[model samples]
Target: MPLSNNKSPAATDIYTISRLNREVRTVLEEVFPTVWVRGEISNLAKPASGHLYFSLKDSSAQVRCAMFKNRQSSLRFEPENGMQIVARANVGLYEGRGEYQLIIQSLEPAGAGALQLAFEALKQKLAAEGLFDEDHKKLFPLFPKNIGIITSATGAAVRDILSILKRRYPAANVIIYPTLVQGEGAGIEIANAIKRAERRKECDVFILARGGGSIEDLWAFNEEVVARTIFDITTPLVSGVGHEIDFTIADFVADQRAATPSAAAELISPDSAEVLIKLKHREEQLIRTQKQTLHNYQSRVELLSKRVPHPQQRLIELIQRTDEYSMRLKHQVEKQISNKKMAMTEIAGKINELNPAHKITQQIEKVNVLEIQFKKSITRSLEKAQDEVSSLSQLLNTVSPISTLERGYAIVTEPKTNKIVTNTKHLKSGDQLRIRLASSEIDSTVDSIHEK
Candidate 1:
């Protein structure tokens, strides 16, 4: 707008809308430096230009406020009408319209309301399911191969984790899976990045991290998909979302929970030099125990040798016992032989006293008497034979012819030396002859007898 020069007999100076707006902006900036204003939000408009135009009022008065796209991206949660909030902003005039409003730089909850109730309800629901149970939590790997990070690539949380992991263990590897950590569809993106890392098997462990913000700002980690994905991950998870006081569903289901991005790095890997020293100490202990065992065995061997007797002494004792037994056995056998000899002598004397020779002599005398009786029988048989011979001779005489001559019958004889009157021839010769009657004998040599 053009300004009039001095002297009141003048025409009005015309100013363009842009010129007036610039002048008003200068005035408003000077009157109100950047400040914090508390009010209830209403008539909120979110247009395609990525800007939020809203009015903040109490019961009686209201003022317009604007949140540009660049500033809107910084808000962690959606803004709506009838929400009580405290806006930290600067008072300014719109260059196009010359209207004054607060250019909000930051925002926060003004009172405990719907948001606080929703927070408590979610916390209770997840807690009842044992999502926050320590027993179900996986212990972060002591030596992670590659730690995955799911956060904005340019965020300070990434730089913090990388710096800490490198300083503690220089050899540890890291992989970043970029994701939106807040706002619409951000929770899904954060969950998807975690699931993709698991599918790819790219990292041994994961760290979901972001710098501290309002509860609304950290709500992405509290979403259902992000929480379940952390619970379901095969890779061990480490959550370092927000500050120490901040808690989310991801923190409860994660394998390990760290209070900050730097703390998460520490949990993943510790100092290498300290681990080496502990191993060396264990090795020394084992060596000492083995040496003690060897010494004990050697002592036991020496003690056992002292308890055993020498072989020569054992043999000498056995020989003396054998000699004593041999002498006793020989004495017992000799005594038995002497007793047997005495018994045999007594038996021989008894046999001699019982002889039967007298009885045998008596039997021989009886046999001689029987022989005498037999001889008497033989003499009687001889007498009987003589009587038989005499009888036979008498019988022969009774039947003889000479018996007739004896009864007075005469007989003649002729002989030289006998005479008989039988033949006259013999008488002529005058031979000598003897004749006898029956009573007498006749003797004749040659005689002639005459025929009667």
Candidate 2:
């Protein structure tokens, strides 16, 4: 393509496509400067280069736009197809394609600020992924040894946090990880500061804080990179961003959320005065217990002392009692011997009065006298017995069977039965018999029967 000189008919200026497009781009940029274009986004394309290419169209027509990587980095909300947006860009022509398009510098949703929508969108995303889950949250150390503050060193947030922490617990070690909390690339700097703190491993816990501001001023904390970093760190984190009502993605993802920077300090630091008071109370209790134990031991020692006896005194008392018992036992033995001696003497006197030799003499004399009397009586009794015997003999002679036998009568008896055979009827022939005639006896057998 050639550019013709309108003033000189014979003069001609030839141009290449690149040169022509360059001139057009310059002209459009110079004329348009920076303008706000409001329309519905369509055909949105985001490539790996981090640039956005889209068309902004209304009811009748549309314009092509290109947002470069540097400019796209400034976008808060993601541009989507069919979303109504207002882009602040400069009119320009694409040098390579020679296509007319707007060079977008900034973009926002039609109804809401870019930062707010971005904050809400990221908060929702991370929440859905359980980044803000209670299970993922870490508990703040009761007493953090080293506390890292990720904020601008000169910002009021650091000052407030330091003041409160020092006042509550002066022993706490505080470290400041200085970073930009607002403006361009603040999010990157903030996220990098967090990483550096993690790598250093210096702090027991982290306090991500900043002064109160609008959403835009507090935009770094709301960035996805910063939020994800807070969620991923092993160290416990407390987010104190903006005012009490203001909240960011960092707040949702951090382990604890404080209303302000001072509040975060209060939450992390323990009160030294209260702890000291409790320690003093415990010390007093221990002292009182030890005193009570000592008193009890002393009382036991006193009670035991009364029950123990003096060794020498107790031995002397036992020796005196033993002597008294020995004397009593000796006296009882002497008295028993004296009484026994008196009883023996009385028995000896009685024995002498009835002497055994004298009694024997008297008994012999009486025996002689009785012997004479016994002889005389014996003589009389002998005479009398003789007379009686004679009379009895005469009577026996008259009645005795032997006397009849002696008078020429015979007695017959069966030899086997020794029965008398008084009648001839009782005698049997051939039976053996004995016949007694006075002093003689005859043995015979019956030969004849006699009845008389």
Candidate 3:
């Protein structure tokens, strides 16, 4: 073959196959940088490096492609051979292998043939917004008073939820907020039912449920509208859609996710048998505790009763103490009586030793003699006092005013103050005076007075 569009080179112009392949690689690099190519994958290889090596082909032709670890890590789902894919890649040649290939940067499932792409797209979008995050999830209540159901009124999901709710907690009221479970308007209808249940205050919690179905059949529950409605509802939400392996948008947005409708009911309500068993066990424990406590108190009372003395024995001790006190008192009285008698006898002996009658006669004789002497002395004294008194009386009479008057002496008195005037200082000229005689006084005016 010619290297250029000329005749084959002789010796110097001919290049080896490797050199030719290198020329082809250089040309391909110049022709394409990165491009989009659609094909089905085959012979896929994933090694320890996490790089993907595969061949992309149509029925007519095939090309070698490689996705490095960085590009492979970006894929949301695992890729395999037979997966119809659209790859964005740079065209290049492997120098070592001397082969032409594409170095892939990214790949996606071809929409015209993809089955799970719609679901993946929705999942990615919702996940980006944290609708599927555990932090936003509400814990299922340990006890639910009423369970509101948003599902088809005639669907199997409703019957399953009701049966489980009744079996677990018969007291819980299960209200149905019926809605269309499938078809065009199903998402809006389900959202509306949730809102209505909240507005009506019909139930403490809600469950969005449906039986198993194809992904397309269950798409209503997976709609963003329904998921958002569950998130915004004030009542707690529990989602039970399809089977255990099935997941939906509503599951991410709900407060609780259950694999089946019956499981959702069981998650929200308490188990009847378990509760009853606990209650009965507690009751038995309480009764046993009360009986033991009563026995303890009764034993203490009986023990205290044994320690208490009898009333009759206590009375006997008190009576003995009283009798001893009485005997002591009687002895004290007799001793006092004997001591008094001895004292009286000693006084009588003293009286007898004193010769009372003879002494009394002597005392009487002395008193009589003293009385006679006193009378004689008193008589003589009386006679002498009488004589002296008569003489004194005569003397006093001589000094008396009446005697003085009888002797021709008169007492002069002042008429205003009734004072006797004996000296000239007591009398004033022109002062009225009275001359007191034995029986009468004559008034006079002090004309003159002489100094003593």
Q: Name the runs in model 1 displaced over 4 angstroms.
A: 1-83, 86-115, 300-452
The lDDT of each candidate is 0.66, 0.72, 0.69
Cα lDDT, model 3, residue 347 = 34
lDDT for each residue of candidate 2 in 161-258, tens digit (9 for 90 to 100)? 98897677666678999999999999999999999999999999999999997677888888889988887789999999988988888898899999
Worst 10 residues of 1 by lDDT: 351-360
Top TM-score prediction, candidate number = 3
TM-score ranking, best first: 3, 2, 1
Could you tell me the C-alpha RMSD of candidate 3 in Å? Answer: 49.9
Instruction: Judge candidate 1 against the unseen true structure and give its global Cα lDDT, from 0 to 1.
Output: 0.66
**For candidate 1, lDDT tens digit of each residue in 52-104?**
89999999999999988887655655788998887879999989766888999
- TM-score of each model, paired residue for residue: 0.43, 0.46, 0.49
Off by over 4 Å in 2: 1-112, 312-452
Ranking by lDDT: 2, 3, 1
Residue 143 of model 3 has an lDDT of 54
Question: What are the C-alpha RMSDs, in order, of all predicted structures?
Answer: 63.6, 52.1, 49.9
In the range 307-421, model 3's lDDT, one tens digit per residue, is 3333444433333433343344334434533453454344344432333333334434653464355335434533543443344343232221112245476888887777667
